[model samples]
Target: MRVSQTNLAGDLLLNLEKQGAGPLHERVKRALRLAIREGRVEVGTVLPPSRQLAADLGCSRWAVTEAYGQLVAEGYLEARSGSATRVRWSNAPDTDVARPSARQAPAARFDLAPGLPDLRAFPRRRWADAVRAQVTQAEFTELGYPPAGGHLRLRRLLAEYLGRSRGVSTTAQDVTVCTSVTDGVRRMCHILRAQGITAVGCEEPGWTRLRQVIHAAGLEPVPIRMDHGGLRIDDLAGRPGLRAVLTAPAHQFPLGTVLVPERRAALLDWARGVDGVVLEDDYDAEFRYDRRPVAAVQGMDPSRVVLFKSLSKTLSPALGIGWVVAPPRWTRQLHQTDQVVAQPSTVDQLAFAALLESGTYDRHLRACRQRYRQRRDTLVQALADQLPGAPISGIAAGLHLILELPATVDTAAVVAAAAARSLRVADLAAYHATDARAAHGLVLGYGNLADSGLQEAVRHLRGAIEGSS
Candidate 1:
């Protein structure tokens, strides 16, 4: 039952010598554990037999046997008298748990519903290199718990990058790193609550999750309706005690309308009049295919607007790294209040800083812009060819677009039909706070949808609409 050296690639490649000062058996265990944790060895992979591994490591048979025995007891490996010792645990988190019914929906085959980027294009190697570089070069003290406001180096780089790219005028001192837009909204809600604010204005046909976040954070989300231009400023006019608003101005979510220049000015003016703060969730502003992306509202009056941007759309949500550029007053409050919040690791922050410093982030953006534009174009063309006379909007910017369906068509029925076909699509009415019976539109996303399946997906969608209608 002994496995030979040639049975495994690199002969179980354990660098026991570099595992620091320890007993031979303990060092062997450490090396195996490191390999398993790093995903260099996969779950269910059979380890070389004790004698073979011991010979490869130039260690005693007792060392290998004891290491294997310890790992087996720790639930990292499994061994039997007659069978080979194999990995029992995987590096991935345990997601198979009892959850609420609402969180247990089956995944659709073709997910066209919005709010995701092409995860297939994530720069794994480049990111890994950056992580490695930061881990090796970072100061000894930097490896500990990250600063409450995040790593200073990343904050500075983010400040400069946002100022240049999104026209957000701010210094590093004003930048407080947050986990995501959701995290930023929650934090801002708490901050506003501290300021004795009870209500916050949110777009009616906007991201539902953020509105829920606001509610969860103990703030009433006042639904302000939006049109083709953007959020209706008149809605903010007479709402007493409402001193804060969460908005995605550059490219709104679900609706995907860029706030017109006049509306932008009006929003700032409204904020100023009420001594309010505009929590700008700069969502999907990076992937505008039509023209140059709109400058952030924060740049116009940083005092009134707290800008939030993240790598979620541009890079990947898995990064869990984003930032908030607030006025000096809010920035001070944010840092002071961020005591219990879990900060992103210092290594990730520094690695992202490295990406920015080396111009890799910009290059990645350029590539994404080109790829997304093509995907958008292909999807648009497919939709046009399949469903003529169907008014399509929101295609000028962002990852998703709006398809205006016939007034007689049932949006809910269309969604059900699409789901039946294993092609997921969103009903526009779902985005609105109030009943939107008249809003018969389907929100289709081209971001994560495969380019190869564009035509086929559109065909299935057409069938869904036809069958539903």
Candidate 2:
């Protein structure tokens, strides 16, 4: 009983040490205080003696003594010279020791989210084979901490993969792997801000996540409006002080408009004139249903554009794999960002490389492109048949299309009505950064729904929109 008691206290102290930095005494004090406040150290629970705790932590006995004394002064723990110390405070909430898990969003019978894929079609067996190959073939040296950039072979393969598939011009040396497009955006913002960039312009009806990245990096996000030709380059002329801009030039999110050729050239010229940079988010460019998607803008000027592509949409987000093909000037900084903060997961990096090397990754993509094309076609036909005169747009070359509703339609009301009927849908108003450019519409994602399921969802959706309008 005595031995088990001492070991319990020792284990707690050791776990606490790993949490933060400071003098040993201060960390010990903070950890114990939190434990008591949170009721982990329940009131009247006996604590280990200072000498035992010091030996457990490999710290001087005085450090433990000081920590206990400080807590005693704060009335968190009580110590009687002849008796063991006990927790004296109990300010914790009256509830379970662990809080209930976060509430999940209500699951809709028919989910039409823009960010999802046909999860049922994920290449599980191919992925398992890749993982097995990695374990059997990997060297002992590969087990250690991953490289600052990532697994070198994986970066090389991804560089080649992007060139073949997306026409992104780059050598293996220019690629830096990240967990997702969001991760790449954050690192780019940090590096650019470090280089004295004060602000960046993003497409107005752009992704909300991109705006969050800008805010997190302490750089201001200026919402640049878009039109039929895509983001207005002329509007950027007024903000000459802006140092960078982010675009999805191949196919803009939600609206699904491609950046026209003239604007693409002018936007590049603007970046060059201001000595600025462009971050191209090539998110779902892989699953263009109608035609072969346009090549990335990074090919136009590798020195000026940083292209971000991720497997989250193409393969599975569970893999958490992505890369940023940066200009030469920013390559070293982007690589160092992962090294300094959080390193990439080596196992995921390795499996992705194995998939690429064996041609399984490309094969999976070809299969997915076909499957997604069928889904897109099914969605278009279902809408045209069941929900006629819906005014569909953006079906030219993306996984999902947009439906522009009349200005009188209450987009939010339509979304609520759909949700009430157990159908998931999105309002375009939520995508806008500022009220100035907010449009009333629905950004319906169809790459995941099945034949009958999609037909049923659209019929319900049409009723919802009509009822709300």
Candidate 3:
């Protein structure tokens, strides 16, 4: 067998030929596996057809097929019923090896799936430093039950930070820290329900988890459509018994449309007119790519808008540190809810406060924003090159983009094909409350993938979409 290697600038190449190996299939299988493991055949890449690849390597198609079959069995390759074989992204053994019944293993290779940050870049050293400093200098009573709201230092820092960055005017007294946005929304709904508001107007294609939370709290969710500028405000002009509305005005979840100035004013006007509350989930406002982020609606009408933001998208969700700044009217009720369900960790709050105060948090946000913008551009270009006819949307901000496919393509089928290739992705249709009139597509998240990984993932994504179509 003759094996040759070429060192390309960005990619490695391995050429294998069968010589005196016991069997051609065995030789090809070993070579393919080596190429994949050694970064030759990168993850989320489509392998050549059995015949073409065999011909290139001077081997029989049977040998290539057999080798591919073996690789598939070992989770390195994926074979669709009628589609060509491709390298499985999930075959990377480092992160996807062990499985616990309770939790699913991470995806094999390029996880373009949405709602995750770059896990590799977490600031462990800085956090550890803060933890050590807090432990050494803290009062003995710091570890006790947290204040009904949250850590005073964090609250004060967040008050100033949110005002400057997100334009949410508030005092530390109005800020109530919770475990996550989900917890905050649930508590807000409970407070509203108690106030005799049995229904909340939710965005039609809003975060599914928020819908569940509202439903679980015995509140009916009235669906309102969203457009490029923001939510369809006219739909909720005079709805009765609608006590509140949950909206992601900063960047509408999944769709990524910034609420325009007119709609923002209209939403606040509605709330003021109806004496209703608006739970503004200001998720990912700081990661805007095109323009400076629009101010929070809370700033326009703080009395009616309960603003929520967290480190989930900015820093990491695992930090479990988020806060809701409501008007003084609802502060007491929110505090009572926090007391009953428990507040976020004191240690995490203190550590985050230190990060924010020391400017580490701002620096991290700037770095991530730059990196994510590049990644987003890479994915967009790849999709344009591969799926040229597809209508692309939501590329302006945030970590993900929505690629709208033709009506002839089955979204569910594409999702299954992606899964078969061990490439995790989310179907855009899945995020809608009702059937959407737009073409189907997948939401691709580039935040987690490095430059190489982003390109490869988009390549594999194109192959999967093409194969399914």
Candidate 4:
């Protein structure tokens, strides 16, 4: 019995092409196993005869037969003498595996959690086009195992984009592409460790992941506090043996205070004085709604500063494509560590580069800015009308803004109340790394929410605050 066509399970499409890294027979076995595991290939479904499958795949019959034999032995499929192979795998996972249980949190009705962009505004059509173009027109070399650094076209394009847009002084030779901001920072920490730097200073109320990444690289992350002027450079004098600093100078995280001019100059001077390196995170600097844009700290002194940015907030976090502009000394170090720590695939890199070249990425950013601006405006007005004189900070820019409740209101109480009501709002203390807490407030993100949505969210949040009192 010959089955010439590829097997299809109802309306489910099987991507025989996604035969991920392995030998041919193993790839075939893995794909079929996944289909069964995912319930696409239902139990008791008979697989195509090996000879027919081989002819359809343009492979030898023996390969298909061997793959089927292995799957049968693994208990994913059952085969008998003179019988067609049938799926044995079930949709339900095995209860025998002692998996740790976690209490699932209630889903928020209106989530204004910071550090996330409006996913609804994601340019799906443009992104899909970019992917299609990449797969169709990418060079044959790009289809093979990607180089340690990244795809050369993407590296060159990113170098150009960052230099022109962010004033980052870098060339393709100096850039290293990784999966995320933390990945880039982790890589830099390892490089800094090699430079005899044992400890680094990070903003006290900074990105929580920064400290974790720093610790993972076997370096101590000293908590450096920030005022309205951004990270306190004077505090650096107290931390002994600290030679590196991680900062979001353009628009500080959670707090949203841009590093003042004096502190910016002082930071560079301190770096020069101590021969220290500054790891600058350029996360969401593109969405400054007010005030003049601050140039990247890396632009001030590229030799001493490493710049990191990702498409997470700008485009989508799902892409997981981030770049690092390291100085010449550190650029070479990436290659050394990258061998032990594997890098992301070249497929998405090509797609991103296509978006960059066609200017689709920039257009998407402009549209998102407008949509988010309206949402932000709606939330601000609602907050002003409902709870006048509420201390709202970090509103001048970024997808999220900070709303400081009266000190009388217990931050935890409001959070619990909000959770109980299915309204998700994050507190400022959550961003603090040290034992000392920062300002107590809700970090409200309006990017993913609509103008109508914000009115409802603010109402729920205000109720939470009132309930706390």
Candidate 5:
């Protein structure tokens, strides 16, 4: 290990100061011993030359030599004829080797769970180039902690990109950068709670994590029934106290139904009628396979809707970046609360902004859409050949599709059997907020599954399903 010579000298000097009423050599020896025992000087760390260390510590060379000699004798240091004195002792136990986990279930070989994207398709080279460029060219101020809301450059680019791409009407001033969709939702729940909104309406069968976030935020999550058209606006009738609602308008999760245009207008009208907010989760709107992506509902009325988007699906979750386009009222409070919160590093934000400005992000999305569409088709074909009569939906957009099993089939048993075969899948009933009987199927995600092994994976999944049934 390469230890900093200057830091080593400083540590020894400090340790020497702590030693009381002792001879110079003994004090030096005590200091070195203490430094070694406390791991301040880790094993394999090459120390500064005795003469240089003596000069730095303002001590005689003999004292330093004597201390080194003593540490060597005590097995705390190593001294070779041609080598400088180095630490050789360690108090820490060896933990470099990995041990197997005791979990009873077999490790997943193929992941069919929803919400995961084609991780292998991430633009690593382009992202690395952007990161390197941003880091080298960044200003001193830009390298410091980011603003509470987010880095200004990323916010500006996101506002422009969203407007041009998704028809989202927003400005940098209205965007609040967040870590993820869950973070954005949690932040909104707090804002909504502060505004006297005690409850929020969510889709009947929705993403479970966001519902948990809303509940944890001390706000009631009312499940609004959904039909094929998407969330039934009529379900909002009885909940007079529900001032806010979260919906993935472009592609509702689990069901994968796009909110029809009429319902979109009606939903906005409902929000306006109650003087409430529409928490629009622009989920999987980026990876549509059939036609051009649907314009964001926030475009209809920005004043009444708050739009949330994240790079977790488009790029990778490892980046932990998302944004919120809020109405002016909520925007003001989010800005105030976020002043005390710091976002992702300015370097990451600027790099992502650079990725967008350079058109690399868009190009990456196009490639992903093509790749995911092909993968989806392969999975669909395999399912058709194996499970002939099974109904699948939500295939027009996003990385996953719904495989509706027969009413006689046990969804839970299918999931368990899939797991036994090292094929990870989720039960559709788990995503429902209230009615588990409403839907029974598998949310199959093909994004990250390897193309070469996909056919075999599906064969195994088919066997699992048939066996379970």
Candidate 6:
């Protein structure tokens, strides 16, 4: 029997005629499954309300409900109460087949992935000692839900640490603990949205996943351009209704250019003129290879900039701890938001605080910084030896360097070739917006790679590029 198709509310409508069907409910279910299988209802696409769909299809709501129930049970659709049902992608084979049990895989080796510090170097013994002391001395109530902002001891320690190291002047009251930098940005976005601001500027060729998070928060991600010296402040000027600007000024992500003095001043001037908030992400600010690290922008204008830093790059990403120092005006709002969302783990915070108090953390930072500097130098030398004339940026700071390639070399193809060779590398173009005219390159992370592995990885990368070309 021929079925009539109808366009309803920009969604594809399926019309199935009764044709010797045993049950109407089964027929409806079959039709919906066919539609989904045929790619009519795309994955993650929301379907019309069940009631609305039932009414349009001349069937009782129960029929539509049952069909939706079957689809959900089969993993073809996801039904969240009070939320519209969405088509779920089921193309990927059962992940368990390829994913080894965390126990089965040996400990991670040669982690060339950026944003990870030396886990082996973490002071586990010191942390254990601190945990023992804290638990022994603490009252039973100390184990209760922590203050939404953070433990006062940890906050105070973080304030002093940031103030001394990064030159960010903030009190314990101005500091709020967050799960990570992304969490802080999300909370900040909510606060800004409540204040009637819906758009924020993100650096182009910046942290790709963080930009996605801003968009996921229902805010516009205005891609601001970036050059060798960090974000292009000129591109941000005169942009209307821009509520906030998220930046990694200390050591710019993907392209590790320190925000120059002139640009930093210009950025502050622009933020003050537009009444915009600047989020200073001091990501990997502690591991400068050659010179002293640049002081955070938040240090220059405490009122206008919110400073964020995490131990993820300094110690380990598993240590889900980061601190944010906001202006006095935002402190209360951020604290309230933190309370609404559960606060970070108290044990981890106390352990971190103990690490800082014992001076062990600083010692580790010094040793790791020296090791990473050596590794960075070795990687740069290897790159120069293997891929001579390749423009290398972001060598001064951070664990990674950007190896810019000729426009003729397709970065996507190179990445595919690298993957085939069991070499993992990030494509620089993936960080930019579709319309952005940014240079294509690879972000080579040398922090986790041993000296030997670093040389081998560079050789593989060179081979990948050649094969791709």
Quick one: best TM-score, which candidate? 5
Candidate 3 local distance difference test against the native: 0.81
| lDDT (10s digit) by residue, model 2, range 334-365 | 88884555555787789889888889877887
Off by over 4 Å in 3: 1-99, 104-106, 338-340
Error of 3 at 24 (Å): 60
Write down the lDDT that model 4 would get: 0.82
Give Cα-based local distance difference scores for all models. 0.85, 0.82, 0.81, 0.82, 0.85, 0.80
Poorly placed runs, candidate 5 (over 4 Å): 1-97, 100-107, 338-342
Better-scoring candidate (TM-score), 1 or 6: 1
Misplaced by over 4 Å in model 1 are 1-107, 436-438
The estimated TM-scores of all candidates read 0.79, 0.79, 0.78, 0.78, 0.80, 0.76
- Report the lDDT of model 3 for residue 172: 93
Tens digits of lDDT, candidate 6, 136-222: 876687799888688999999988988898898889999999888888888888788888778889888788878887888888999
Q: Candidate 1 on 1-469: residue-level lDDT in tens? A: 2222333633556676678887888988898898877877777778888887877777789998999999989888888789988887775666222222455688777879898888888899999999999999999999998887889999999989998999999999889998888887788888999889899999988888998999998999999888889888988986877788888998987778889999999998998999888999998888888799999999999888998888888889989998889889877778766567787789999989999999999999899899999988888888889999999888888899999998889989999999999998999988888874335799998778888777889999999999988
Question: On residues 1-469, what C-alpha lDDT tens digit does candidate 4 reach at each position?
Answer: 2212355434434455676776778867877787777877776677888886777677788878999999989988888899888777775666222223354444577878887788877888888888888889888878887787888889999999888888889899889988889889988888889889999899989888889889988999898999988899999867767888999998888889888989988988888888999999997788887754678988889998999989899888888889889889878787557565556668789989989998988888888877777778788889998889988888878988888887788988898998888878887888887767657777878776655567777788889899889
| Tens-digit lDDT string for candidate 3 (1-469) | 3363342212435455532456778877887788777765655566777776665666678988999899999988778898866666444465333223335655558788888888777888998998888877778899888888898999999999999988889999999999889989988888998889999999878788999999999999888888888798888885766768889987887888888888888888888888888889997788888988778888888888998877788778888888999999899998897366767778878888999999999998898898888778778888888778788888888888888888777878888887787778888887888876444678877777767676677778887878878
lDDT of 6: 0.80
Model 5 TM-score on a 0 to 1 scale: 0.80
Stronger candidate by TM-score (5 vs 6): 5
Candidate 1 vs candidate 2: the lDDT winner is: 1
Pull out the clashing pairs in model 2: none
Off by over 4 Å in 6: 1-110, 338-341
